[model samples]
Target: MRRPRYYTPTEVSLHNTIDDLWVSYLGRVYNLTPLVEEYKGNILLKPIIENAGKDISHWFDPETKDIRTHIDPISRCVKYYTPRGRFVHVPPPCPRSDWVNDFGKPWWRDGRFEVGLLTAKTRWIRIINTLTSQEQMLEVCSEDTLDEILQCYLYYNSHAASYTWKYDGVNLDMSKTLSENGIPDKDEEFYQCLMDRDLYTESICLYFNDDLSEI
Candidate 1:
């Protein structure tokens, strides 16, 4: 049996109007807020909104050290940020100081581009969570959870509507040029464009027809 929620549906809506008057942290400015905003319009917001309260606040609030913190790492697995202002996987490589001198690693060779926040934070947070005696603190997600995180990352990143294409052969249609040059099976039907006049003459003559005695 559950006691009545003080903020019922009607009360919640009215309170929402009042809450709107308060600084929203996300008022119209996209960059000013965290990635959590993009999640609000989602269908999942219903359950989350319904449950959000003073209790949930303690979770997200830095000072509370609530149980929500442990779950937050898992809940937020899908989205994270990079230091460059780009949202990527793994937090951006630590600032140069933290990388070579402080952390002592060749972070550059690690392909620092895919760096994101969730996984990186998980590494340190797990240690703290384990050593801490508090049971309410947030726990880190397991390695197996990375795939799901990546899936969510891709879904959110894929929303961009525009794209760019290279202009290599827009005018001349260089399919034949590519096939004849070095592309595999250019002589067959796949890249018939590679079999064009200038291509065949240029590539075929340059290599196969050249004098072998010089070799």
Candidate 2:
């Protein structure tokens, strides 16, 4: 027998720049529009939706009582704002350091911080270009892009902070798992989540390095 699918009402509203992909479990809104329309429609969004079925309408839409579960990643991000009136947005501060054991040493976990910063920067660039009547030099987007963009930010930040350390040692290898654990019949949600984390973190390290050249 095949496994059941999950969908969310938020995805339905994701045809454009919709904010707040509400997840009942999280109790917080997430940006999903970018994942739906931007970032080339993140590879994960479609599968989850296709499997969810029409019943997803129950959660948000009154027309259909389909128990929607997942939503577009980009639309999910609008819930977070750029704080005060600053062009730059810092990562949500942590009273305790987000330290992680990687590269055979202790490292500051900076992915969340970088993600928040990049999101602000991306939003700022768009706002500036919009005001100048520019041809939209900055990209218009949804919250879904934050995850991928954050990966790039963290990649660069890590390298700049601890250039001497080895990155591969801390990187999580998700691509390798898909090949090794090929369960075509199943959604591979567990494996994909791991891959997402690995990809996001490693990419952060790389993006951080590349960003240095601009400085």
Candidate 3:
């Protein structure tokens, strides 16, 4: 089985659109595109639309892993405390004849919307192909191991696994994460990489190791 894909906040932010909305909450990433499409003209969708491609952890209770709620002052009953505004599948503070709770499971509670886990932290790295003289910059999860990162590099080099990954001339441990492999994270100066990418970005060079596995 393939490993569960990990996504950084920056990557999640790219899908900020009605037809491709995504959000992260309680350390999990969710694809809210269908929910938005199904409720396209809904006024309740406003807050979600405005906050697309952003973290909504504040909207949920970490302990319950569900939406935050509070006792309504007027109704004197518990209600979703959507300070931003009531959103899709959330019941109204008071009973309404038009309101429907037929949707089996709320979008947030449904497993279908869950795409992946939110990375605890993100970092940038440069992958250089010594043989082809080609290079690619990647925004990867700090929790990713060399093997997992190799999967990301496969788009640039299909035979990435056949290449020996090295950092500062020492071989990399496929099972270990970047920092565990002795690669220091320059997160404090990570933004500087935007100005001089090559100067601050750490590089992992790949040396092709010819093998019969290649067709």
Top candidate, metric lDDT = 3
Which runs in model 3 stand beyond 4 Å of their true positions? Answer: 186-199, 211-215
How does candidate 1 fare on TM-score?
Answer: 0.16
Q: Candidate 3 residues 27-50, lDDT tens each? A: 889999999989989899999999
Q: What digit string (tens of lDDT, one per residue) describes model 1 on residues 99-121?
A: 22333332122222111222111
Tell me the lDDT of candidate 1: 0.24
lDDT-wise, the better of 1 and 3 is: 3
| Tens-digit lDDT string for candidate 2 (134-195) | 22122212232333323333433423332221223344232322112221112244355664
Ordering by TM-score: 3, 2, 1
lDDT score at residue 132, model 2, on the 0-100 scale: 24
TM-score of each: 0.16, 0.16, 0.83
Candidate 2 lDDT: 0.26
The candidate with the higher lDDT, 1 or 2, is 2
Worst 10 residues of 3 by lDDT: 190-199
Structure candidate 3, residue pairs in collision: none
